[model samples]
Target: MSATLNPNIFRAYDIRGVAERDLTTESVVPIANSFAAMLVDAGSRDVALGRDVRASSPRIAEVFRQALSSAGLQVYDLGIVSTPMLYYGVSRFQRGGGVMITASHNPSPDNGLKLLINDVAISGDRIQEIYQGAQAGRKIVADGGAVHTTDILDTYVTELTEQACIGPRALKIAVDGGNGMSGPSITRLLDRLGIEHIDLYCDPDGDFPNHHPDPTQIDTLVDLQRTVLEHGCDLGLAFDGDGDRIGVVDEEGRVIHGDRLVIIYAREILKEVPGARIVGEVKCSDTLFSMIEKWGGDPIMSRVGHSFIKATLRENGALLAGEMSGHMFFKHRYYGFDDAVYAAMRLLEIASNVPEDAPFSTLLADVPDTVTTPEIRVDCPDISKFGVVDSVVSHFRALRPVEDIDGARIRFENGWGLVRASNTQPVLVLRFEATTDAELNAYQSEIMEVVTAAISACDDSV
Candidate 1:
């Protein structure tokens, strides 16, 4: 416990850090102890543990298992599975809690843990409690316990494939796992759907020798995009490091954002369950909401986190929810977790019913096109980023009302701009959208002016 721990590693949704630095074996003991104590308090004696194909994942997961076992918890080890598979193992095994050793879409050196208790994703203050307990080196009574290893992969894939409600239209898709854990299961799921897949970088390489596992980065998806165009594939599928988030490209080689992806899912879900509530995160296009309403479904706007969106979905009884970052949760036909492989299956099923003449992009031909900026991240210290957002919020509120749900979303007649602090990184995440390019630029400029001043003001105070 004497390892120098970086306080910033305790993120809003998970405990993330540069693996070799902040997440050293010595540093993980207290954090694991804190989680074990929390699980014990929640009456979760059986814990399922899984890891991504990161260089440090096995070591980190082993530490977690040992610590939880020391606390008299039964640890089920799901060896080298994707994040969604870990979630599946938790539900299938009926474990009271689960831990995933991964950093999601972060860089290679980064590694972290995603946690659950009582089948609920832990976030907000609960995460802070873990951090606090770890800071205090919280000690729990250690009654001896045992660890058991099992493989939930085969059962997990079978269940997902069995859930396919697809037509007989065979598909040709290019899948890029980016050397993460999604490669093995995606192939299985697609095969079960009877779709032809051109696989790329699906191998499990912790070093990420080919490219980073982040599909959102545009660069990481270059190979997939090229393959789709060259091979005349129907679509391109990409996954992040742990397979929870997804990245999609159309037959035209255009990136289909998560917001648009959810729109497609919503349209289909509403057909099955009319008036089903669907959640669109603040980052989604405004047209998504209108279309959901147009299609005889209830639309709810949400903040931008998997846990936040999941909570919103459960609270509102929403049939579906999605983020701009490629995290989609479905309560329509499967467990309400973000499983990229499952999402691909659903997308393929939707594609099956399409006419032969139509391209994948035609799925959203009904919605009007608009201009938007990709997520723009600005450097700001974790301690000061929230202060910057508060300053921006106050500055905007003085002139016109702002939507401060997750951050400051300043609305204009034609467009809106957002300024929010990243829960996982030391930065401020900003995005803007408008009916036209000129208006989009204007909104971005206006927001950046306030943001620049706010950042300076916050930095000065700090």
Candidate 2:
């Protein structure tokens, strides 16, 4: 067998940890071998291997390629591409699997692998299976296992631009790539579409020295916001580490969150595909679902996570889906995967219709203003986090009607709140929304009270 596998590294949707500590060359080898076996089981010997621009990524990717090759799989090396590009590379084949090496939004020292099997996102049991197989150290050699280095960036750009259905006018915008994987691809997209943009940290750097490559955290968008105001641009777009999540700033330098982004996309999409279903996670603003329904589209409320929302989209055949964490997925004339670069273009596509004289914030003028809290992450042990969530569910379920698809989404008379265990971390994520500050505070107080009690109880009892 291989070195004792770190169970913590095998997360829900990915394998993530501090690279040198948890994912040594010895560890990655068996993991890659296991993933190769997974591809083989899926009736495909071809595996797409891609990596981010992190300093440690190349070494990890090389280890993976070697292990995969040794395991008798044809490895398609799509070098130094974003996570979405890696997904796209795998999607090129009928039955394909791939691994993207990047700890999305995590710090520089952290690294991870997001896996897809037969182009379907792997999660839950599948990830655990990989971990189990890795422990087993299954390695089989077959003929014709080799590495095929490929270049699909131009083709990806060509296809994305070919499907362009934007307004006539082009506008100057600011783009903050966060020195991650979004630089080259977004620049190429902006160039092809004739969109003027001011670049902010558009070069890929593993250290992410400027700011953390997480667009969801408002702290990370300071540079992007400043750039937009200084440039007198119509808007700003920010991308996360692996270029799958997007953050936007309006002409007035207001941060437009993912929920607002979804509404904007939904409004435009409804014009073309009326009554198309859209999915958004519970952490999203209630306005997202209400507006989608009001705009003649079916809105499906999903649990918070990429894999869960993707499964919801497939189940409902939704044309679009989004998360509060800045992941926008569109099957409307494009692949249904979270791609910040594609979503940025789509945002521009919608904004292009707006008059040059008007500010971009006007697009959301109809979206009823509401008070919403950013995600509040409460520290809870992995063992007790879900239990605490369940206690919260029970407490709320006894008090009022609640939805617990992934957590307790309690809809109070004046507001709504969510309490759920994070899929990838040992924390209970909470968010609240209301029409007024008082209502928002009341909702938060009520939820936090129950959450605190439940967590205390979990700690003492179990």
Candidate 3:
């Protein structure tokens, strides 16, 4: 937080900004130092650090490592790794916490840091403390801490391979890593597991030559879908830049929604761990929650955001958790963290064991079909987004029953609508789902009217 640093880079979840404009070595030094100071203040010494495959990531990460070491914190450097690997390193190394230098699903030329403390994501006030401390030029007077280089690539691949419980069907799959951090690790894991697969953009090219490393986008997954069909692969999988969230396509080249993917996992998990807790974000489809209940598993809906989702998962001992944004976490037989690579492997395991007559999509055929919209983001300033959502909440709550857990999810007789503020960007996230197209349109239209009025009021007041 030097005088030139942009404080806006510190967001509700992680630290992020344009690489060229805001995140320079000068800015990274102070930010890293301040974060290390937090660790020192917490009586912690060892901190693991990793970076994605972005062009600017390595440079910023190097400076960050130097600053952390200079700030008297033991830095365990896991160079060029996915975000999940950084999380795993913290637990694998038994460190106080860790940091991942990534922009996640953002476009190239943007980068930032995701921090952890005590193996938990640091957000909200905890993130603010680091920014404030940096802005104030807080310092911890102590000798420089040690920096150690450790490679967990082989170990990570081996662990994932062993945990993969796929049957011996030798199913073919098409995988699109989108030239992000997932290539090497995923290829190695699949090879070891003896899964026949076709790889697309499976090299770590920061340029992202084929497509943006965002699986959630329709344009980005186009190649994955085509390749799956052309190659006669049973399914296709896509990963984001940092390799934590996932996107999937069935044999028919149809993109499976995130909520449906959760149902697939919950069905398998509930059979073993009956009455287990299953968590989903408020934006998730109601069908997902209902299916969980039908399977005898308790469903808990929480606010969206990885940090909040993980915290809720841990608190409830949930066997599985997911978001509409494609993040899936498993506490069933593995660590309770979101890893797209692992989720894909697990999906493959499930797909391979099914009978020849039943395909992967067939497993979810019983889910009540509903018309649902993908998350629609409305442009609203960061300063005013929350206020707009609050206004919407108030306007809708008096007229109908609403669940205000994270946002206002207004439940109608036949459908529901959600209005929430996006944590990372200046936008208001909205979604609508209903059993019928007419109901869906009515719900969407009514909610959008309220949202427009609320935003107008919020802007005038602000």
Candidate 4:
């Protein structure tokens, strides 16, 4: 039977869609079969699979597993594990590839698949090939494929605890999983690491009864910040829906953004692997690049997306890479998958080694302060967002000097502004960084004006 895929659902980086409308069983089964066929063609007979805490994930994963088994592939079901765990399983088992059923920071109503080939992320143009193969009914089915179930929770915890460099510091920590897939695994790992802490919303609930699973949004971390302050914990950590990304709060209950977290991680990583290459997305603060260089490491900027970051890291042999959205990849001690649980352990290890008075907040103290706007996204049609960015880029290039990295970054004497199309959402993303708040506001206003003008131009053309 041929699989039907909505062309709209085949995105640039991964497969994601609302479960009810875009990812029905009919659409998923054949895709899974085709994926298994792809693996067979690549000489891979065994594949690992995992899912998140969303209600639809279990059903969807089952259908996919059936397809894989029917196609003559061995399926290792690491049930209800994080995306990172799936990656680790694939790398550890030396299997063909892995699939993670998750919408990753999306709402509970959404579900999707993140595919890996030989432990490397499959994205960009490769996603198109997979969709095309599935639609053409070109899947292979053999007689030797089998399905097996195994729980890797204990192994995962042991790996994280062993990798962490924690010391004798009896620090109190607060962890908020937002009722996502990270709860059980993170709690287990923390306990094994001998860390004292409070766990909030650590129950696996698809309903997300506490708040949305996305920790990048300030509102989502409000409860976590409060919990840390109330408990007088040394710090706080929060994970997204699939537990692949992390957001942090300091001992003083101050929220730390991903760029700052990267700085902290980079500093610690440098101690172990000096002069290593580190990569950051275009959205990261300029200070990060400077600091990495000052620490005798090379800093490379890449497009925003975990796939892009991972591919770039592999190509450049980078030790670490991160984005402003809390996706961090580490290659020093483990495979370079973005794992928030592992990241939290690394942070704790670094904190344990620091002076008694030195805190996580101190990592950012030496960098010059810059006023910047939090990533502001404007809702627009998916088709319109990219065109709007192109139009804005053209206009900015004509009117002033701009850096066309991942987007149009207009440079001024005291500040810089950027406007880009979000790869993961139907929105236009805007950010500004400046020497002063007033300069930052001016740059933001100017960029807004340009973006507004570009939208008008597109509207007129339409």
lDDT of each: 0.89, 0.88, 0.88, 0.86
Predicted candidate 2 versus true structure: per-residue lDDT over 269-305, tens digit per residue: 9988999999999888888999999989999999877
- Please give the distance, in angstroms, between residue 327's alpha carbon in candidate 2 and its true position after superposition: 0.6
Question: Which residue runs of candidate 3 sit more than 4 Å off their true CA positions?
Answer: none
Candidate 1: tens digits of C-alpha lDDT, residues 2-55 = 766687777777888899999999899889999999999998889999998778
TM-score of each: 0.97, 0.98, 0.98, 0.96
What lDDT tens digits, residue by residue, belong to model 3 across residues 177-207? 9898888898899899888889999888777
Runs in model 2 lying further than 4 Å from the true structure = none
- Per-candidate clashes come to 0, 0, 0, 2
lDDT of 4 by residue, 295-323 (tens): 98999988889998998999999999998
Candidate 3 — what's its lDDT?
Answer: 0.88
Residue 13 in candidate 3, Cα distance off native in Å: 1.0
As for lDDT, the candidate ahead, 2 or 4, is 2
